[model samples]
Target: MDKNEKSKPSYNQDIIKIIQARYGYSQDYIRKSIRGDRTGIICIMIKDEYIRLNNEALKVIESQLYKL
Candidate 1:
């Protein structure tokens, strides 16, 4: 089987872990937030923004927002 077909059942778990790691959220919280999530848009947004952020500026911004 191809990769997508072989991993279909584990996709949700994989997504959950990725979100949790990135946001420092618990697995349960991520699961609930994404229960009806559409097309992984939230995850994609987060990832895209993450890539665009500079390490130093991101730290400053996060600090200002009390994110760190």
Candidate 2:
């Protein structure tokens, strides 16, 4: 990713922690799932959550930029 871009939204962050807790999975597994190393329901759910959170965060950043 470019330096100006945020890091991956699902790694070493509260978002992953929260999801891990809810799904009873390890952080590493979650990361792997997000990185597309794994598959199945959990992977699908995590991918969806990651995308939703990432988009929500971007929208917030965009609105803040517009206000400034």
Candidate 3:
């Protein structure tokens, strides 16, 4: 799979809103930042958060697989 495009179990507004609420940024700005449409300390922070959430989701999936 492409590094840029994540597979299923993707993120949604709930996760985005979590970051927005925590960091005090607009949902549009956070979405742009995650999409690599912008750059800056704030953008970097947003991207990092997105990656963190993605990884967390992956771990949950992995654990479910192991339960089989």
Candidate 4:
């Protein structure tokens, strides 16, 4: 792996898949969020951007919001 690849933390694929499938978010977005980017999928909900979300996405967003 390259230095950049080695420096980035690895996230759980299962959780990423769950979030992506439920939120319709791209893998890149999910990966960024997992790596501490706050402007990922949660921003869609916060800004009320009219994106459709699955049940799990709603739950995940709620949980994340509480952490803030």
lDDT of 4 by residue, 1-68 (tens): 66555565655556667666778878787666544565645854522322233345678989999999
Cα error, residue 56 of model 1, in Å, equals: 30
Q: If the candidates were sorted by their TM-score against the true structure, best first, what order would they fall in? A: 3, 2, 4, 1
lDDT ranking of the models: 3, 2, 4, 1
TM-score of each: 0.35, 0.68, 0.70, 0.46
- Clash counts for the predictions, in order: 0, 0, 0, 0
Best by TM-score: 3
Per-residue lDDT for 2-68 in model 1, tens only? 6555442223455456656878867655544444443476656654543444344556777999954
State which candidate, 3 or 4, has the greater lDDT: 3
Top candidate (lDDT): 3
Model 2, range 34-54, lDDT digits (tens) per residue? 888999997989978977776
Whole-model Cα lDDT of every candidate shown, in order = 0.54, 0.80, 0.85, 0.59
Off by over 4 Å in 2: 1-12
Compose the digit string of candidate 3's lDDT tens values, residues 15-38.
898898899989888888998889
Model 1 C-alpha lDDT versus the unseen true structure: 0.54
